[model samples]
Target: MDMTACNVCGKIFGASSGSVCPSCRKLLNIVYDKARAYLRDHPKERVNAVDLAERIGEDERLVEILMLEGRFENRGEDAEESDDDKKRKQLLQDLQKNLASMPQKQHETGTYGSDRHGARREK
Candidate 1:
């Protein structure tokens, strides 16, 4: 049994993981609901963690924790990746995979300058 202090209410309790205790977790769920509702109504508008916390009357840390837990995604304009960047990333990954799959040739025997297996012959 792992013991921890709740991040929300600062209560001591037995928790396997995460900082919030069961009671606070329940309360945080309610907070999540309110935040989700707010987002739904104002889908076009942008809100930072602090602003969202203020709008829902919840702690900013709780809003951040929910975002970290993937309850919601922060799709700010600055965080958006370009399609060209995505394509370039994919192309780089493909090149790396192809390079890794190719068989490696032995360059030399025990000596550094000479090639015994003809893997790299000096002209």
Candidate 2:
């Protein structure tokens, strides 16, 4: 048996894996049940972490942790990507493309220099 600290309450306990202790894990199960029930009742609603926490009367942190644990998922219309999500993905793709081209661009333009004049001096 290994000892670890609970991420939620910061209590030390015996555990072999996961950052949370046994008590926190049990509480998380209860919270997960409530959140699942809420989701079932509001199947079409787009419920973020805060909203779910409010609906279930649980801490937003717990809801967020459950979300991170893959215990909760958006369903139906709520699962669809919003404009902001699309824009975020586009921005990420653009950034990746720019990063991916950096080496090639530097090679083509000979911009990778170690000198103050932007030129490599060979001895």
Candidate 3:
């Protein structure tokens, strides 16, 4: 079997017979066009994977795959952004970085809550 890295994420995977791996087969994630356009249109609203997925109605996993390599960055005057836009981008970046550093899930040792069966849930 053949292998290669994803064009967007750089993660290694099989390359049976295409430029893009099977994982990135969908055009939404496979191509950067939409994401680039998104970045431009929402000049003030810095989009995260979740937002993109909701807006485009694609899988969140696919959005993450397309955006894994990028974090919010202000385009500045080149994108004709207003001061508010730059501020929004910076704020979004800060929020995203904070979120990224957080653990995937809470590590709770005790009972979080109870279900209908009266059994406590633990992580």
Q: Which one is best on TM-score?
A: 2
Per-residue lDDT of model 2, residues 36-84, tens digit only: 8788688788888999999899999988888887776553225444577
Residue lDDT tens for model 1, 18-97 = 88888777877888888978986898878888999999999998887777777767532223435765787789999998
Clash number for model 2? 0
Comparing 2 with 3 on lDDT, the higher-scoring candidate is: 2
The per-model lDDT (C-alpha) reads 0.75, 0.78, 0.62
- Tell me how candidate 2 scores on lDDT: 0.78
- Find the 10 residues in a row with the least total lDDT in model 3: 108-117
TM-score of 1: 0.51
Error of 3 at 46 (Å): 1.9
Candidate 1 stretches with Cα past 4 Å from truth are: 74-123
Q: Write the per-residue lDDT of candidate 3 for residues 1-123, one digit (tens) a residue.
A: 778887645678878735455656656443455555666777677677888777766667666765654423444544645688689889999999889756633554335433423653342
Predicted structure 3: lDDT: 0.62
Better of 1 and 2 by lDDT: 2
Which residue pairs in model 1 clash with each other?
none
Best by lDDT: 2
